[model samples]
Each structure stands twice: as structure tokens, then as C-alpha cells.
Target: MGIVVVEICDSNFLLSLNIEEIIESKYPEVAVLFNDCLGFCGLCRLKPYAMVNGKRIHGKTPEECLEKIKEAIEAELAFYA
Candidate 1:
């Protein structure tokens, strides 16, 4: 499969949940990047969200968002497979 870029804002709540470790451990092919600012305005401050292969994925809670991110990653990888 090809590389799946998962971009998350540094201030996102997902970081508090060790999202980087969780994603890397679960999907070694996924490159999770934490940037100082994703340029999404104030979205990061209100909810859990990330960019999966350039597609925005978000949820009301961190756990929910993480699940969505995984789904998006799988979908993106499927395109290569």
C-alpha cells in the first residue's frame, strides 16, 4: 500500500490521547504528522479532527474521531491495494 498521510494539529485534543502512538502502532504505513497549525481556523479548538489523505475527518469526541481517521486510512490504502 502507499503512504497515508494523517495530519493533525498540535493543539488538537487527540494528542492528549497519544494519537500518534496509537495510529503508528495500528497502521505502520500511516504517517501521522503533528503540525503547529493546520490552517483550519478554530476547528481544532472545538472538536477532534484530522486530515486523512487530504480529506477532513472529524467527530464529536477524540475516540470517535480516531475511529473515523482509521476508517479513512483504510479507505485510502484500499485505493492502492
Candidate 2:
């Protein structure tokens, strides 16, 4: 019913994949924000990750992380439905 906030670190390797475009195009109600730092310690440097509705979702690879992010978003949307 409301916007789903997906926050990613600006320095995250996932950015190189144009994740913002991919996610926003797929989910109109989702907002993908690339912040300077997500304050997850140094985890951003080690893996692909995103904060979906304040929940941390990460994966070994960027592609995997993107899929998990979508799944997390879908799960959140289901509650509204």
C-alpha cells in the first residue's frame, strides 16, 4: 500500500549492475536509494546487499542479492495485499 524503501550503499559493487534501474522498473512502488554509507560496518565491501524496509538482505553475488531483494520486496507487498 505504501512505498518500499530499498537502501544500498553507494559504494556497493551492486551499483555497477544498474540495480537502481532494474528494481525501480520492476516495482513502481519501490524506491531504491543509494546512500553514502549504510553503516553496516564494512559488510558492503565484502558482499552484495540491500536494506529492504530496514531488513538486511545479502548474498554471495550481486545477481543473487538482486533476486533476494526482489523476494523480500514481494514478501512485504504481500502483507499489504
- Tens digits of per-residue lDDT for model 1, 1-81: 339999999889888688988998988899888899999999999999999988999999999999999999989889888
Q: Give the C-alpha lDDT of model 1.
A: 0.91
Q: Residue-wise lDDT of candidate 2 within 1-81, one digit each (tens)?
A: 237999999878788688988998999899988799989989999998999999999999999999999999999888888
Q: Model 2 TM-score?
A: 0.94
TM-score of each: 0.94, 0.94
Could you give me the TM-score of model 1 versus the true structure?
Answer: 0.94
C-alpha local distance difference test of each model? 0.91, 0.90
Clashing pairs in 2: none
Clash count, one per candidate = 0, 0
lDDT for 3 (candidate 1) = 96
